[model samples]
Target: MSAPASAAAQDGVDRLTYAPMVMADLDAVFAIEQAVYPHPWTRGNFVDSLASGYSAWTLHDGDALAGYFLLMLAVDEAHLLNVAVAGARQGQGIGRYLLDKVAACARGLGAESVLLEVRPSNLRALDVYRRYGFAEIGRRKNYYPAHNGQREEAIVMRFVL
Candidate 1:
């Protein structure tokens, strides 16, 4: 599917486009994921997510892959499973763009809220979520596998649509 290009970037000059994720985009997606995370999701994980009917979309800046996000609609809520902006594109508000896009998708799907779990250690993401109006609802203990072979707690956050 095709999503119309978004209005100019925050700078008011660049244009962005959105498209449904395809297998062909996996290589780039994996590369960005691998670069951004200490423990990245394998290609198989992405494949399975697609096969399970999750909604995934990629954002592009001209011909370059800028970022991507995944949304899973369940009952009346939508879950934000993954959102990653290319290393080079991080800190440019692309992540925030993806968050807004997915939340709009959730609303279109008849969802009342958008829920996501972020590692407590992911300070960057925590800050973004907070700025995006996601409130911490609860925590999942030992929910994330840490690099030290130990588990880290996950902070469950939600944005009521």
Candidate 2:
């Protein structure tokens, strides 16, 4: 385990604990995903990731689920498959904390860069990625399912290690 990371929430400062996510955490993690995203990744997606041995982790603030992230490494690059902070825990620097952890994990795996895709309308996420040194690399058309049978494009971003 690493030193606890702190995030200032509305209640006070929360000391975050990082841990490898397991099957047992799925209930809480899935709840967060359903709550935070209209087009959330299915629970099966998470299960598959774990089954495939991707890097999956959860963040907790004193037994309270705070956030989670999934990373997939391919050759010299790492891809951030999914990352989310609890709705109540957003804007408290937890996203960056998760990113920092994921980046470290990638680097440890010998990845030279990290890549991700974000919906263009996800302004908050876009800002976070940019602030964390990710740059727009390209766009993927119709990459994300949208409301009413539509599809949304994805803004691809890359962060070099």
Q: Quick one: best TM-score, which candidate?
A: 2
State every prediction's TM-score relative to the real structure: 0.91, 0.92
- Relative to the unseen true structure, what is the Cα RMSD of model 1? 5.4
How does model 2 score by TM-score? 0.92
* lDDT winner: 2
Model 1 stretches astray by more than 4 angstroms = 1-9, 12-14
What tens-digit string does per-residue lDDT give for candidate 1 at 1-161?
64334433464224778899989999988988899987789999999998898999998777778999889999999999999988887777788888889988999889999999999888998998999999999999998889779999899999999
Weakest lDDT window of 10 consecutive positions for candidate 1: 4-13
Assess candidate 2 and give its lDDT. 0.92
> Lowest summed-lDDT stretch of 10 residues in model 2?
4-13
- Candidate 2 structure quality by residue, lDDT tens digits, 1-161: 64434423423334688999999999999999999887999999999999999999999888789999999999999999999999998977888888999899999989999999999999999999999999999999999999999999999999999
lDDT for position 80 in model 1: 93
Q: In every candidate, how many clashes are there?
A: 0, 0
